[model samples]
Each structure stands twice: as C-alpha cells, then as structure tokens.
Target: MTADATKRLCDVVLDETIGRATPDVEHERAVAIFDLLEENSFAPVGHDKGPYKLALSLVDSKLVFSITGEKGEPVATHILSLTPFRRIVKDYFMICESYYEAIRSSSPSQIEAIDMGRRGVHNEGSQTLKDRLEGKIDIDFDTARRLFTLVCVLHWRG
Candidate 1:
C-alpha cells in the first residue's frame, strides 16, 4: 500500500464510530491483545509442549502483516501454534483497512466507512473467528488495534 493508503487505513481505524466509540474500552482490549501477542503462552501449533513466542512483521509489498513465530520453527507447528491468533490480528487489520478503503474510494466519511466495516465484521461471522481464537488466546478487539499501531510506529520509516 502507498503511504496515503496506509494513512487512510489508520484514519479509518482511529475514527469515531469503530475506534473512537469507547477509548477506554478499546485501550483495555488493545492491551490485552498486545500481551497475548508478546507472550509465549499460546501453543505454537496447538501443542501442549509449546509456549511459543509470537511476533508481527509488516509486509509492505503485501499490504498486510505477517504473524510469525520463533525462527527455524516447523511450519506446521508454527501454523498450528499461531493460526487462530494470527487470524484475529489479520482480520482486525483487514477489517479496518477495508473500511478505510471503501470510505476513501466512495463519498462517505471515514467514520461511515469504519461503521460499515465494523458492521461487516459483526455480520460476516467475526464471531466464528472469535470462537476459533477464544480460549486459544487471551485478547480482544482493542488490543489488536493497539498492536497494529505499535507495529506501524516501530517499523522503519525509510
């Protein structure tokens, strides 16, 4: 994505309808997700032996973030380990971006786009995604946004 696209994505996510609805609630959620993302608590591939560390790396070429595990890890183990958690993060960002993109490309305000996106997530089986993630990881929507923000901020600008 271009820098403009990235900024627009961020704006939609941070908009009042979806993101600014309840700052405190979002903050709490974001913190919870961040904790889960940074920890070694979740199974890498749903194994009892795992306490695999989770990491996020931005792929500008793909315009999406990669949810990865420790280096040299088995792909199956990594996939099994972090699949649910990764889905949550990926979906969250995509939802936000989709909203932003729709709004930017249309005549709607950014907030309207966010609302539409949020509704889409809710109506389009975000709960199913949540069900897959629940009990597997301790996180919520807000934390996912915060984690995304942190990743964007920490990424190299040049």
Candidate 2:
C-alpha cells in the first residue's frame, strides 16, 4: 500500500470511534488495507488471489500478510512496520486464544464473534474488535483450536 493509504488506515484504527464501528461499514479501511497489500508487491510463489490462502512474514521489524491464488501464487501482499503495534502483541495473542477456544467448542456464536473481531482488527476502522471479543460469553474448543493455529501463523515473526 502507498504510504498515504497506510497512514489513513492507521489513523482510523487509532481513532477513538473504532469501538463504535463495524467491519462491514468500513469500506475505506478495507480499501486502504488492500491497497497496502497490493503496493507491497509480495505475491505468493506460484499462485494468484482466488483460493483464500494467506501467508504472513515478518522481517526486520516489518510484517507482511499475503493472499494466494488458486495454484498457490500470491495475488496481494500487505506490509507494515511492527514498531507501532508492538505494544499490542499480548492483546493480539489473547484474542487469538479466545478465538481458538470458541472454535473448539463448536459454538457458532463464538466462531461468529471471533470472525467479527478478526475483521475489526484487520479492517482498521473497527475499534469494537476488541470489545466484541471481550464480550464473548462462551467458548468452542474446536473452533478455538483452528483459529489459534491461523492466528499463530499470522503473528509469527520469523
């Protein structure tokens, strides 16, 4: 993504109103994220962008998230500096754990909540991401396990 786009998304995420917004209503935020990923130009080894596969890389304090195509090629890549959000690492991990628990228990509501929370965190304008996650009243062991794995993959710094 362009510097301007990244700046915009970060601004939205840091804004006080994030807790009141939802991912579905954050078009600009989503666009900014996509723009960043596209601008970074880190396509997968042999794929495009159709299959919903995502890869993440962290190097020299930079974090990259990428989507792969049908054949396992990268179609989009998002790169960002880890310095600004380093303080939130623990929180991110905690949320991921909760998401995993929800998934493991086979609770649709928990899974949905985690999905929404994930969207809010990834989408950039939804502050409610954390709040929604905190509000989850139950846990699903199965969903939690899968979500934990996915989150771990995304947060890996190697």
Candidate 3:
C-alpha cells in the first residue's frame, strides 16, 4: 500500500486548561501550529485517517493527543506519560535561555554555538516524541519537531 501524502494535520488546538501562556510561549505555539499545518505527514497506524485535527493537552502528568476527523468526529486519543521527556524538556528550556541571552550580549559565533546546542536538545526531544508515538501515530521528523514545540508550550509554567 502506498503512503497517503494527504494524511496530515489540518488543524491543531491546545487545551484551554493549560492556562494562559506568556507572550513568548504563545508566539512559539502559534509558529509551531502554523508550520505543522503548512506541511505534515501524520498517519495513524491501524487506522486510515487523513487531514486530522489534533487537540493536545496535559492531564495528570500524561500528555494527551485528542485527534479528530475533518468534521470534528472522534478519531483517536493517545495518552503518553511525561516521565521520559522531563529531563530533555528541562535541558531544552535551559539551552534556549542561554541562546536568548547570547543574542543580547554575546558575539555572533557565541550565539551560533548556543543555537546549535539548542537545536540538538530540540532534536533529542523530538526523537523521544517520535519514539513514544511509534505504534500510535506515524509522523515524519519535521512533524515530530513541531509537535515537540507544542509539547513544550504545554509544559510552560510562565
């Protein structure tokens, strides 16, 4: 069977319960959603679904993916424990802080170095997300990366 290129996310929603995000976090979430909707390959394993809508949230320390059809019908709901991602997320945030600081006071080379480290940590988190969703959802690396951004947004306390 050929892979359906149409199997992608058409829309993304973050649970309101996550609370109001800070300006930076809101910007990140918006960008992630835009990038994700612009181009993504999200296919649910064992289920033929295309152009899905994803509603992401965190409940009881579990990350929830509440997927839906184009018409708002239920598709699939996958819950993943946040245990494996805690350390990586923490690292990513710390590196991001350094990168932001470098942008303000450091030289170009220093900023570049910090950005590289930030990307590396981001990739690790994305890979972990892909691994966690292995059997449930089949998403390409870029999609996973964008989704990881959303995951981090949900974890944002400020």
Candidate 4:
C-alpha cells in the first residue's frame, strides 16, 4: 500500500434503498467496501484528516458522497449528477452482463476478452469519478475504482 493510502476508511453506510439491489450489485458493494477498508487513499481538500465515515445516497437524482471524520463530524458532501457518467455506466453494465454470462460457458480466451472489456469500462468509470471529485477530494486510482463500483451498485436499482 502507498503512504497516501495508509489512512483507510473505518466505516461506510450505503443508503437503505440500495440494499434491495440485485445479488451482483450487492456483491460488488460488499467487495468494494471490503477492499476499500483494507486499503485506500481518501483526502478531502481543505479538511481535517480521515479515517472518514462515508454515507452514500441519491437525492434528486444526484449521487451524494457524504464524508465525515472518524468520530462522525461533517466533513464534506460531494453531489455528482449522473449525466456525465451515463454512457460509461451503461457500457460497464452491458459488458458485466456479458462477462458473467461468458463465465458460465465461454472458453478461457473468450472469458479473458470479456474480462478485459469489463476492466476497460471499469477504468473509464473510475477515471470519470476521479475527475468529478478532483477539487472536492483527492483519491488514488484504486480508491476511485472501488468507489466507482459502489456507485454502480447504487445505480443498479431495478
């Protein structure tokens, strides 16, 4: 782990509405949260340091990333509109579906190809999120990728 990632997340609270998510979505959330807690870099611009607790939710169609200090003091709230992420998220979902299906019957080479496409989409989402959170918070690529996965889980309400 990088020095920047030394201060990891101590707690996370996803919106209750997000709990009814599909098994895949729930799995994504679980894995991301687990990995994020194991290691991550989360530094909010111009704020006190963390071990932060994040409360993620959607309000008025906007995704909210609400962060607080370890003791739960309000640190910052970054609300992002889903417009810019629409294309990448849609593509990611499509590829993930195909990737999952491929795992059930496809050959190793075919599965590898689909997995590569899935990773590409995942990277796209991660980069977009990193850009969107640029000024408000500074997060490393790994953190951004995990965050993106969690965001996709929130978007999976169907």
Predicted structure with the largest TM-score when compared to the true one:
3
Query: What are the per-residue Cα lDDT tens digits for candidate 4 across 70-109?
Result: 8888988989888898899899989989999999999999
Name the TM-score of candidate 4. Answer: 0.87
> Where is model 4 more than 4 Å wrong at Cα?
1-7, 17-19, 22-27
Count clashing pairs, candidate 2.
Answer: 26
**What TM-score would each prediction reach against the true structure?**
0.27, 0.31, 0.90, 0.87
What is the C-alpha lDDT profile of model 2 across 21-61, one tens digit per residue?
A: 35443543445444433433222234323323444455666
The global C-alpha lDDT for each of the candidates, from Candidate 1 onward, is: 0.39, 0.41, 0.85, 0.82
lDDT for each residue of candidate 1 in 68-95, tens digit (9 for 90 to 100)? 2343243221112233344444565567
lDDT for model 4 comes to: 0.82
lDDT of 3 by residue, 1-158 (tens): 12564588888988875677789878877887887887788977876756788898778888788998888889899999999999999999899899988899999999999999999999999999999999999988988998888788777766
Whichever of 1 and 3 has more lDDT, that candidate is: 3
Measured with C-alpha atoms, the lDDT of residue 23 in candidate 1 is 56
Instruction: Please state every model's RMSD to the true fold in angstroms.
Output: 14.3, 16.6, 2.5, 2.2
- The CA-based lDDT of model 2 is what? 0.41
For model 1, what is the C-alpha lDDT against the true structure?
Answer: 0.39
Q: Whose lDDT is greatest here?
A: 3
Comparing 1 and 4 by TM-score, which wins? 4
lDDT score at residue 134, model 1, on the 0-100 scale = 59
Candidate 2 lowest-lDDT run of ten: 6-15
